[model samples]
Target: RTHLDPSDTLELRSAADARQQWIHYESLTRDLSLSLTEQLRLILAPTLATKMRGDFRTGKRLNIKRIIPYIASQYKRDKIWMRRSVPSKRSYQIMLAVDDSKSMGESGSGSLAFETLVMVSKSLSMLEVGQICVVGFGENVKVAHDFETPFGSDAGPKIFQNFGFEQSRTDVTKLVRESIELFRTARTKTSSSPADLWQMQLIISDGVCDSSEHEPIRRLLREALEERIMMVFVIVDDVRNKKKGESVMDLKEAKFVKDESTGVSKVKVERYLDTFPFQYYLIVSDVKELPGVLATLLRQWFAEVVESSN
Candidate 1:
C-alpha cells in the first residue's frame, strides 16, 4: 500500500508511475478474467433465458408443422411463421457504490476493495451484462464509470488512480438518491427495451454510516424498497464470532402484539432482509475470496429474477 503524504506529492514519481502501477495490477489479475468469463458464461445466458422471453422480431427455430403448411401454400402471403422464443431479457442496472474514505486505506481494506472492484468491473464488462455503473464515494461521490462505456476501457485506471485519502465522510443517502436519478434517466432513454428492468445497487463499506444521516438514509432505503430496487451492502471487513451469532448482515425489525385477555408485549427479531428489497453480505479480509463470494451472491440475485419472472 502506497501512503501518500501532503509533502510527498512533488517528491513522488510522475503520472507514468501511476499508470505503470495500474498496468501491473491488471496483468497480475489477468487470470481472473478467464475465470470470471467461464462463470459468467454458465450464469448469465441460461439464467436470463429461464426468466426472460425472446425478442419477438427474432424468429425462433422453424417449427416443422408450420413450415410444412407454409410450403403447401406455396409460400402464400399468409404470415405463417413462428417466432423463436428467446430469453425475454430483464435488464439489470447495477450501480456499485464504493467507499474510498481514509478509513478504507487502513487495515488493508483499500487493496481488498480495489481488487474486488477490478474483478467485478472486468467480469461484468466481459459478459456485457446490463448497465454497469461504478461510483467511488466518500465525502461526496465520484462516478468512475457508467453503462454507456465499457468498465475498464478508459475509466478503470482513473478510478484506481484518483482514489485519495482526503475525503472521509460517507453520505449514503445522497448516493442512493443520485443512483435513482441515474436509473430514471436510463429508463427514459431505453423506453423501447423490455419493461423488466431490475435495479440493484451494491454498497461497499465498512459497516459504518454517518450517524447524523441515519434517518434520511433509512427513508431513502424505504423509497428504494418501494421502487423494488435491490440494495446490497457489501461490508468489507473481518469476521466477528459472537456468541449471539448476529452479524451486521442481519436487519433489525420490531414486532408489536396484544393479547386480548391479558396485555400487550413487544418483540424484536433479527431476520434476513426479505421483508425489504435489500440485503447485506459480509466479506472477510481475504481479498482473493471476494470474487467467489460475489459470484455466489450474484447467482442468488439472479435467482430472485427467475422467481419474479415466473
Candidate 2:
C-alpha cells in the first residue's frame, strides 16, 4: 500500500462518493426505462397495422374483412370494400423540459427529476420514433440535448455530465418561450415530414408554474397552441408525507382520487395549475410513478393518431 497525505485521502474518498451516487441513479432508472420502453412499444404497435385510407369508394386493394358487409349490402354499397395502407414506421418529435431550481434539490426532488428525464428520454429514444430534445430550467433555461443530434450518440453523455441544480428560481414562462424558438430553429434545419404533426413538449416539475409569469405564460400558451404544438405538463406532487385527513384541495376532485388516504391530491394541484395550464397534464406522487404515467400518456396520444389515420 502507498502512503498518502490527509488531503489526498480526502480527495479520493470524495471521488468515490460521487461515483457511487452516479451508479445509484443510473441503476435505479435503467430498470424503469426498460419497462416503459416495452409498454410504449406495445401501445404503438397497433397503430402500425392497416389503416383505412378510403372506404365506400374505389381504392388500391379491397379489404377481405369487408366482403361480408359488401355482400350484405346487396351489391349496392360498392364502397364497403376498404382501401388500406400500413405505415412503415411511426415517427414522432418530442421535447422534455425539466425544472432544476434550487427547490428541486429539496426532499431529493432533484435526484428524482434527473432520474425521470433519463428513464423517459431513454425509453422514447429506444423506440426509434424520432429525435428528442431535453432542456433543464431554473432561473434560466438551456438545452440539455438539442434536436440536431441523436439522443444516444451525443445527447446522452452531455446530459449525464452537465446536470446540476444550482438555479435560484424556476421560470416556467421563459422556458416556454425559449422552446418555441428552439423548435423554430429545428424546423429550419430539418426537412418537413409527417412527423412534424407529432411534435410535443413535456415540462416536468415538482412545483407549480411560477405565478409571477402568469400573464406571459398565458400569451406563450396561445402561440404554442397556434403552432399546433402539443404542450403537456407532468407535475410531480409529493403528498406522501401529508396528514391523512388533510386534502390537497377541495374534496370534489377528491372523488376521482384513487388513493383513499390522500383524498384529492391532484385537486389541490388543479388550483396551482390554473396559472399555467395545458389541456394535457399529468399528476403523480413522485418520479418513480413516471414509468406508468408516461406510458399511459403516450398510449393515449398514439391512439388519437390511429383514429385520425382512419
Candidate 3:
C-alpha cells in the first residue's frame, strides 16, 4: 500500500473542467473492474466519469501487477505466477530517493518531478499491494511516508503537504547512502525472509551528483547490490516547456557525462549509472510519459526475474 501526495494547490477546476478530468481518469481505471476504495470514489465523484474515459482510451492496456507475468512469459519464456500465497510471497519494497539539491530549483522543474511522484503513487495505490516508502533528500534524507496498504485521499494529502515543507539541500551521495542504511535497518527489524522480499531502490533525479563524494556513492551502490536490492535509476530529464518557459537540454548537455577510461568517472554520471547486482536504468525526457515508461521497465524486469527462477 502506498500513500500519494496530493498537489499543494488543489488543481481546482471549473465544475465543467472538473467533470471532464474525472471522467478521463476514471475511464482509464474502469476497464480493470478495479474498484477504488470508498474514499477515492468520493473524492472523484464530483467530476463526471465520461470525461476521464477519453484520455486512457488507447493508453497501455496493462495493470501494474500484470506487467511481471506478461514480461516473464513473453520475454523470458518462463512460467510466471500471477498470484502467490501471501506467506510464501516476498514483500516488495519501493524506496524512492528524490533529488533536492540546489540545482533542482534552477528551472522550476520541481513541478514535473512532483507530478511523476503523484502518478507513481497513484498507480501504486491502485495496485493495493506491496510496501512503499517515499523518501526525500537534498542536504539530508527524511522518510515522508510509509505504507503497508493503499492510503486514502486524506493520507495522501498529508504526505504531499509534508513534501511541500521539505526543502532541498542534501547531496545525492548522502541521499543514496542514507536510504541504503535505512533499508538495512528496516530489514533487520522485520522478521521476514530476505529471499522472499523483492527490494527495489528507485532514484529520481536530474542526474546531478556532487563530484567530491564520488567514492561514497560508488560504495553505496556496491553495498546495495551486496544486500540483494535491485536498484533502479529513473533519470528525470527536464521538461522542454514549463509555465516559466524553461528550455530543455539533451542529457549529454546536462551534468551527466561518462569517461571512457574510468567508466562513469564523473560523479554525476557515475552515480547515475553505477552497476548493481541486478539493476535497470531509464532515462525519460518527459514526466507525462513516465507511467508508461515505468510499466515497460517493470515488465522487462519481472520477466528476467521469472526466467531466472525457472
Candidate 4:
C-alpha cells in the first residue's frame, strides 16, 4: 500500500521557515511512528520467543532464578522442584544506512530521506525487535546513532545537520564496510554485543553510485553475502524530477558531467539495482510512498526471521 504525505508543502525562504517545517514534520512523523509501532507490536507480539526459566517438574539444570520464588511458594516437588531453562531464540539486528550525496537532495529528497529513516527506525525501536544502527553517507560515512546510543531528539537533528548536498560521491561500499567494522569493534568491546544477532542491512540510496564505485561495491556486497549478512536495498528514484513520461526505470541510465570548478566529475545515479545481489529490495519513485514501503518490508522481514528462528 502507498502512503501520501497529507500535509501541504511549506515554502522555505528563511532559516526560521525551515525550522518551522522541520518541527512540523517531526511532530507528524512521531505521531505516525507511534501508531505504526502499535500495529507492529500487535503483529509481532506472538512471534517473540523470549521466555524466562520456569520452575516445575525436575530437569537436568537447576534454575537459580526461580529458587527463591519456589521456596516462598513452599509447593510440592512436582510443582516447584523441577526447573528448566528454555533457550531463547536469536534476535534481529538492523543497520539502516541512508545516502546523503547531492543527488539525493534533489526533488525534495532530503525530507523523504528524513521522514523514511525516522518513521522506520522509530517504529522498529518501539517494537523492541532488536538492536538498530543508523548511518548516513556521502563523501564519508557517519554514524548518526550507534547501537548503544538511544535514538531520541538529539540523534534526529544530527541527520538534518549532516544531510547537506555538498558531497559529490556516494561511496556505499565504504559505508557497508564501516558499518560491519563498527559492529565488530562493538563486539570486541563486549562479549555479548551485536555479534550473534541476525544481521540485516537495509540501505537507503538514490542509486546514484558512480561508475568507478560500482564494481568494488558489488564485490564487497558479494563478500558480505558469503558471510551470511542479509542485504536489503531501498532505491529512491528521481521519478518526480523526470521529464514528460519518463518511467522510473529510466533513472537507471547514468549521465555524467564534469565539474570544472573542482576538477571532479559528477554522475547521475545509475540504478541497475536489479543486477545487484540484494536478498530483498524495492524502488520508491515517490518519496511519499517511502514509509509504507518500509513498513511492509520490515513486517515481512521480521516475520521471515521469526519463522527462521522457529
Candidate 1 lDDT, 1-310, residue by residue in tens: 6688856875345345656666766676678766876776676654433332322323544445555666788876244445534555556677888888886765346665666666666766777657788888887888877756656565677666667645667667778788777767766766445456767787876655544465676788778767777777777764432223343345354556566677867564634343322354645455566667766877897787669867
lDDT by residue (38-117, candidate 2, tens digit) is: 98788754354566765746777676767787789887767754566666564566899988877666634566666677
Model 1 off-target regions past 4 Å?
Answer: 1-14, 46-84, 89-92, 191-196, 211-215, 238-278
RMSD of 2: 9.7
Better of 2 and 3 by TM-score: 2
TM-score of every model versus the real structure:
0.67, 0.70, 0.58, 0.66
Candidate 4's error at 5, in angstroms?
40
**Residue 202 error for model 3, in Å?**
1.8
> Which model is ahead, 2 or 3, in terms of lDDT?
2
Clashes (N, CA, C under 3 Å) per candidate: 8, 2, 14, 3
Using TM-score, rank the candidates from best to worst: 2, 1, 4, 3
lDDT per residue (tens digit) for residues 87-109 in model 3: 35345667776666666567555
Candidate 4 lDDT, tens digit per residue, 99-138? 8888777645666666667777777877776667888888
lDDT for model 3, please. Answer: 0.56
Root-mean-square deviation per candidate: 7.2, 9.7, 15.6, 11.0
lDDT over C-alpha atoms for residue 73 of model 2: 84
Q: What is the lDDT of residue 162 in candidate 3?
A: 38
Q: Which stretches of candidate 2 lie over 4 Å from their true place?
A: 1-22, 44-46, 52-83, 192-197, 240-271, 274-276, 302-310
Residue pairs that clash (backbone atoms under 3 angstroms), model 1: 52-87, 52-88, 53-87, 53-88, 54-86, 59-84, 60-83, 60-84
